[model samples]
Target: WLRGTRKDPPTLDETIAHENKRQQLEKKPINMLPTSYGRDAAQGGTGKCSA
Candidate 1:
Protein backbone atom coordinates (compact mmCIF):
# COMPACT_ATOMS: atom_id res chain seq x y z
CA TRP A 1 0.00 0.00 0.00
CA LEU A 2 3.08 2.27 -0.15
CA ARG A 3 2.62 3.16 3.53
CA GLY A 4 6.35 3.70 3.93
CA THR A 5 6.32 6.39 1.23
CA ARG A 6 3.35 8.17 2.82
CA LYS A 7 4.16 11.16 4.97
CA ASP A 8 2.79 11.50 8.50
CA PRO A 9 -0.52 13.37 8.87
CA PRO A 10 -0.62 16.87 10.36
CA THR A 11 -0.49 17.14 14.15
CA LEU A 12 -3.23 18.82 16.24
CA ASP A 13 -1.45 22.17 16.27
CA GLU A 14 -0.76 21.93 12.55
CA THR A 15 -4.40 21.03 11.85
CA ILE A 16 -5.67 23.93 14.03
CA ALA A 17 -3.34 26.35 12.25
CA HIS A 18 -4.61 25.09 8.91
CA GLU A 19 -8.22 25.52 10.00
CA ASN A 20 -7.52 29.05 11.25
CA LYS A 21 -5.91 29.96 7.95
CA ARG A 22 -8.86 28.50 6.09
CA GLN A 23 -11.28 30.47 8.27
CA GLN A 24 -9.33 33.65 7.57
CA LEU A 25 -9.61 32.91 3.89
CA GLU A 26 -13.36 32.32 4.27
CA LYS A 27 -13.71 35.83 5.74
CA LYS A 28 -12.08 37.38 2.67
CA PRO A 29 -13.96 38.19 -0.52
CA ILE A 30 -12.98 36.31 -3.66
CA ASN A 31 -12.28 38.41 -6.78
CA MET A 32 -14.62 36.86 -9.30
CA LEU A 33 -14.11 39.49 -12.00
CA PRO A 34 -13.43 37.95 -15.38
CA THR A 35 -10.32 39.91 -16.31
CA SER A 36 -8.77 36.62 -17.51
CA TYR A 37 -9.55 33.03 -18.49
CA GLY A 38 -13.20 32.78 -19.66
CA ARG A 39 -13.18 36.43 -20.68
CA ASP A 40 -9.83 36.94 -22.39
CA ALA A 41 -10.40 38.63 -25.76
CA ALA A 42 -7.17 37.27 -27.23
CA GLN A 43 -7.71 33.74 -25.96
CA GLY A 44 -11.43 33.86 -26.85
CA GLY A 45 -12.81 31.98 -23.80
CA THR A 46 -15.94 34.13 -23.71
CA GLY A 47 -18.06 31.05 -23.02
CA LYS A 48 -19.28 31.01 -26.65
CA CYS A 49 -16.22 29.33 -28.16
CA SER A 50 -15.24 25.69 -27.45
CA ALA A 51 -12.00 24.77 -25.73
Candidate 2:
Protein backbone atom coordinates (compact mmCIF):
# COMPACT_ATOMS: atom_id res chain seq x y z
CA TRP A 1 0.00 0.00 0.00
CA LEU A 2 1.03 3.68 -0.45
CA ARG A 3 0.60 4.41 3.27
CA GLY A 4 3.89 2.94 4.53
CA THR A 5 5.81 3.81 1.37
CA ARG A 6 5.06 7.56 1.60
CA LYS A 7 7.51 9.58 3.76
CA ASP A 8 6.31 12.12 6.30
CA PRO A 9 6.29 15.77 5.13
CA PRO A 10 8.15 18.68 6.81
CA THR A 11 7.72 19.24 10.59
CA LEU A 12 5.98 22.28 12.11
CA ASP A 13 9.26 24.12 12.70
CA GLU A 14 10.43 23.52 9.14
CA THR A 15 7.08 24.64 7.72
CA ILE A 16 7.13 27.84 9.81
CA ALA A 17 10.70 28.64 8.72
CA HIS A 18 9.80 28.14 5.06
CA GLU A 19 6.78 30.43 5.39
CA ASN A 20 8.81 33.15 7.15
CA LYS A 21 11.46 33.09 4.40
CA ARG A 22 8.75 33.27 1.71
CA GLN A 23 7.13 36.30 3.40
CA GLN A 24 10.46 38.13 3.64
CA LEU A 25 11.15 37.50 -0.03
CA GLU A 26 7.68 38.77 -1.01
CA LYS A 27 7.90 41.99 1.10
CA LYS A 28 8.57 45.35 -0.60
CA PRO A 29 9.04 48.98 0.49
CA ILE A 30 5.98 51.22 0.31
CA ASN A 31 6.07 54.26 -2.01
CA MET A 32 4.85 57.57 -0.52
CA LEU A 33 3.98 60.86 -2.25
CA PRO A 34 6.55 63.68 -1.93
CA THR A 35 5.75 66.62 0.36
CA SER A 36 6.33 69.04 -2.55
CA TYR A 37 3.20 67.68 -4.24
CA GLY A 38 1.09 69.21 -1.44
CA ARG A 39 2.39 72.71 -2.20
CA ASP A 40 1.80 72.60 -5.98
CA ALA A 41 -1.31 70.94 -7.44
CA ALA A 42 0.16 71.18 -10.96
CA GLN A 43 3.23 69.17 -9.91
CA GLY A 44 1.07 66.23 -8.87
CA GLY A 45 -0.42 64.72 -12.02
CA THR A 46 -4.10 63.99 -11.75
CA GLY A 47 -4.65 60.30 -11.07
CA LYS A 48 -7.60 58.30 -12.51
CA CYS A 49 -10.63 60.55 -12.57
CA SER A 50 -14.11 58.99 -12.37
CA ALA A 51 -17.19 60.47 -14.11
| Whole-model lDDT values for every prediction | 0.47, 0.41
Pairs of residues clashing in candidate 2: none
lDDT of candidate 1 over 1-51, digit per residue (tens)? 113354887578766765575456446556744454334445432232221
- lDDT tens readout by residue for model 2, 1-51: 113354877578756765575455346344535453333334322221100
Evaluated at residue 26, the lDDT of candidate 1 is 46
| Model 1: residue 36 alpha-carbon error in angstroms | 10
Badly placed stretches (over 4 Å) of model 1 are 1-6, 30-51
Clashes of 1: 0
TM-score of every model?
0.44, 0.40
Alpha carbon deviation, residue 50, candidate 1 (Å): 34
Q: List the residue pairs that clash in candidate 1.
A: none
* Residue 36 of model 2, lDDT score: 38
Error of 1 at 23 (Å): 0.3
